[model samples]
Target: MATLTPCFLRIFAVLQLAACSFPEEPGPLISAPAEVVRRYPVFVGRAHRSYTRQEPLYIQTVLKVNRTLYIGARDDLYRVELDHVSGDEMFYSKKRTWESNKNDIRICRMKGKHEECRNYIKVLLSHDGGLFVCGTNAFNPLCANYTRDTLELVGEPISGMARCPYDPKHANVALFAEGSLFTGTVTDFLAIDAVIYRSLGESPALRTIKHDSKWFREPYFVSAVEWGPHIYFFFREMAMEFNYLEKVMVSRVARVCKGDLGGSQRVLERQWTSFLKARLNCSIPGDSHFYFNLLQSTSPIIRMQGRDVILGVFSTPSNSIPGSAVCAFDMQQLARVFEGRFKEQKSPESIWTPVPDEQVPKPRPGGCAVQGSRFSSSNSLPDEVLNFIKTHPLMDEAVPLLGHRPWIVKTMVRYQLNTMVVDTEAGPHRNRTVVFLGSTRGTVLKFLITPSPENPYSNTNTFLEELEGYNPERCGDDSVQARQPLSLTLDKPSHTLLLAFHSCVVRVPVARCQLHSRCMKNCIASRDPYCGWTKGSTCSLLRPGTRLPFVQDVEYGNTSHLGDCDGEFVNLFGM
Candidate 1:
């Protein structure tokens, strides 16, 4: 027997562990189990071919007659149809073509008169048996209607009479009751200011209301609209003096109601009566810099329950968290803020309620893991393992950390967690709600919402654990998980839920009784398998040239790849 030095023993021990840690080839991809849900194909327009950006900042969906679904892409709109049998596979078709033909006669004619040509589709909707399309040109509202079938531009083109009296960049329009439209725009070249306009009836004229009060003059941008007795508008106020060190300014959600602006008709002198502003705390503690990239994109208010409002916000920078949060506020509180009278000295804190932490689902686990070691039983190393170790020099340090464990090595990986919340009809037992969240790296989380026993305002949410990550091959290479926006629209009359997501739209049948009870219970127990450490135990170090027992490959069914059964056979029967 040959004796080895201590240094040689250490090198041999390290080499042995490296040989075992490489992962085996993954199994063949399996088709997802048959599911009885309708999946519709979404058309994202052929013009989307030119949009090479990885993420789309804006995404909107509308249901057209004849069961056709139209999706608004960044530059164009697409039409899609759904299959009735399987909810997994979807077919896509192009519905409308948006070619930027600046030299076209019709486009040039429309722009020549108003001097607001630069045509771009800002909003698309099928309403009142016609297609209502709105866009901006030179900061003016360009409204047009088209025939649903012929796609011919009908009705006279309408432009704002006053040229909006504000920057076209800041203008946004919202549909009010009875064909009434409300437009809000920000002015002031140095400091931001806001103006609201109301238009009613044919040959609708625009009336501008300048809100110059101290509260209204704050550098805030109007982000969303909610319909009620009065149209509720939400704005995000930016903090004065941008913090270069922190990379973010303070922001908050504020609202103004119809009556607060003097019955929605008073044009220029109208003032915001009810103001409910809550300071946004998006900063992580102890971090000198802010995590989020932009404030305007973070705040969006959408309708939740009939009377409740939900605000979706991204806390961290665009790339930091890769997840957004939804906060809820009661509409009743908002009504009080607009109607209730108070002294200027008295601040109205009761008018706005923050969605409690219990109401929000906990953050899902991120997708990375520390590297570990693998110990091989084979005396001769595999060619693949040798190459992997050579390519990944950091694995040298990681193997020792695991105490030379017989395990595979992997690195820290991250994934996206896109989340959305929706309301369901009240059931006999409980009000049914669901949260659909998808992971970019490959998991779709369907969380069923149940009322919390301890908190009336919060809910006990459960996720589906059996379905983990999404299969990468299914979503394609260009598919982005982090930037994909999830939109859910509920058609009340049909009792159907329409979920529009990346690549496809899913229509789920909302049952009177809860299904997947077992899955829900298991998920609640496991919290969807989000908690756990990597499996396997570490190994003890051995001296070099010390003959040791071969370790079995646990993950590979204990198959040994060391000694060749094909090699010259030794006389093992008499050993």
Candidate 2:
């Protein structure tokens, strides 16, 4: 046993932070497109509420189910059909969903003082042939079910204490998995106590330790998704490991097994037994690593290269670094980090250290119980193991990014990249991952990530032209999208990019391949997964539709690497 001095500890942390993930020389920064494309027009659609109100419209959540967009606003829920837009599909102030949209279902109708009781709809999850809706009912949270067919409230309203946030503005996550509802949100009225709670399930209800800063310290949950047997939650919280002058926010990925029954009623009564979290690293590896520590949003787990991948959108939400990044992670990588050693701090004054492997008990502490074992379930596990897990849930090593560097990094930009969505399409060689980033300025940026030509293990990212101030066909220049927080979800079934703003939900095509058809280099440089340069002299999807062959150079902007695009592109450039 050795005790580390304060000076030595500081040096250890500094070196560990720098030499953490990169075991060898890191790859070069990914290259941008040779020519920058700007302001690709987007087909924007604004949902029209049935009627106008006095207060400013504060749109909260836009969930797409089947072909309907279930939009949750401050006081109403408007259901807009995607393919059946009748009236003007523009962002007009007067044309509400009454004439253009399909259904205008009001989910929030609260009666209270406008303090914290304003019925701001927050959580909207489809469950059990209906909609499990919850709202911030003037500080008291309530949840109810609406019939899926008619979209009418059917069930009685019940308490949503741990299922939804008390403040409508707080960042929260609601996930419905295995016929259960799970949430990461604050429970109290003042919005101080944050929790990861599971309710309305066949299994016993479980939650994080209450008032325990070790579990959640001022956490702002980004999103949650079910991967394999575990529910992964991405969030940014105050780091409990470091005690600096100013509190440092660290990105985290927390995991909880879906089948976890609460621990023994004696030691850990209704608390989760399979709960663990690890720091997520989205940094540029070099002499000095620059970190995007605030995780804003995460894309759904999409399969790529025979592995499940999650693309996270991280930014300096604290406004310290005016930059943002998009990082991809393999789900298996995070599973390994959780299975690694556990970290613990002896006291407030002691340094956070990893517990020796020999000290860990049998069957593992934070793992789902086996069907046949000495301790069949967490409730039957030994008190010693439960106590050990109760204190130490954080992993020692941070989860490294998929590659050593971020796929896309934008520093000193005017707008923070708050949200992103990922679309994977078949490329000439393999599957190409396209990334779409939404900014605070109500714009969407597109890019693609492909394997590097020099090193297959490495990756190269290409940025498409920004979707600058171009108006949609129907919408005028004076649209209603304000400079508010944005959220992005890619509807793969419909091939639509669903961008949610404060005022409306805008739907646009995933890729504008035709915009780059004029120039062969530009089409290849676009790097959009849904697009390709065809031999018939046009840009289109990679298919045999009267086109001889498709020319794609997603790897690098150069057509030579594609092996067959040598002379075909020369004629396009008048060479």
Candidate 3:
């Protein structure tokens, strides 16, 4: 064998160290091929929570069990009941407001003067069969419970001493399995410490999760919770001033075991261990100012197939990439990461790739890229393609579109937004997950994993193509266009999925809809057109004297109303 030179030996050493030090290329499991299986429009209605001119940063799914769905919109809560055979019947709770009485004269004439009236509702399921909700009213924290069946207020409103010190804009709550609750308080640009408490029979013992201002940087903004053998808390760290320019922010998923908290203390004394932490790399270049404020109202955690823990998130890029992206790490990965055995060594930023046509179950006619990268294929591109982009920096400056490839160009277009997994079976699909992503202009997508024969960890691509079946152009209807999904829940028993979104409640069968005509006709004739109903269908509207099948009552912005279908048909017919 020829002897290696000293320079070559040193170079080889450096390469070996780099390989060992960096996180192993996320293994084959991370890069397994994936494609869209279906994409369907979900209608969530137009009601939203807004503060001043700032759009609400987060929306949360409070409880999803059976066919009942509960959602949190800032300070209010909404519920939807879905009929396995029909569709969705929706109703919302009254907007609970806060008032303060300062003068006796005014108190005599009025019940009381409200200092503040807010509609934010953060909810938790109590281990003791109660539904606990907490939010800021006026400036104070208020807690309430509801009967499991009637959802009627179970007891007098319990008030917490903790006050929302922020802009009345971004306060939220999370609960642990042990019945402990955490509330994040934000003031102006700063997120204060999380207020912690445990419900002791009737009252809650409150304490604060504290850290030195200098060490922790931004205070905790509670984003998610996990309950199993232990309790985990997830939060977002405020972006540093320099990071603001690059549109980078760090998100952390941390946890404290249930065994750690057993006493009267409101907050746990132990430090949280991070299961997974990532620097959110936005897709849109130069839009660093567009921070994802999802911490206040999004549930990044969900129990899949009844047992597995599924975590999801949406990170927006401000630069050239013009969309929000979705990605997920499985519970096993989370456990390993939490144990400090796993660390992310890949680029803090996510890479995007286009969905191959053959991989898509129901291929769309137009070319489009899904916002994710294959861990295994990261180095598969031709050297020339990489070199060309490297040499021609101007081409790199142009944000790549989804289908335009040389893979690197396509990678630049996607960003991760939100992800969820619905397990069809325990063995192969055990770790299988579904990712829902939102684009910059508000297009939502759905993708799933297709099993692969070559690799145990690697899966073939299969997009959830049915979701896009209701094409507005093909159907000559706009109602079928996919809208931004606010929240998603899976009904395991019935194999049904419900999407809560900005426009309407959309239901897609785990199996195809057998009653396609009834489903499409009802959707179109309803005229509210929130749900995607097929076009050119023989759906008939109820006559003027006919009683409507269902009535929708909504409570939002501190007001409530019962909307009738009398004139709704006119709007549906374009009359």
For all predicted structures, in order, the TM-scores are 0.49, 0.81, 0.50
Top-TM-score structure, candidate number: 2
- What lDDT score belongs to each candidate, Candidate 1 first? 0.36, 0.72, 0.37
What lDDT tens digits, residue by residue, belong to model 2 across residues 217-298?
A: 9999999999888999999999999968888999999999898898897777889988899999998786668788989888
Worst 10 residues of 3 by lDDT: 401-410
Candidate 2 residue 388 C-alpha distance from true site, Å: 1.1
**Weakest 10 consecutive residues, lDDT, candidate 2?**
96-105
Candidate that would win on lDDT: 2
Give candidates' CA RMSD values in order: 23.1, 7.6, 19.9
Error of 3 at 407 (Å): 16
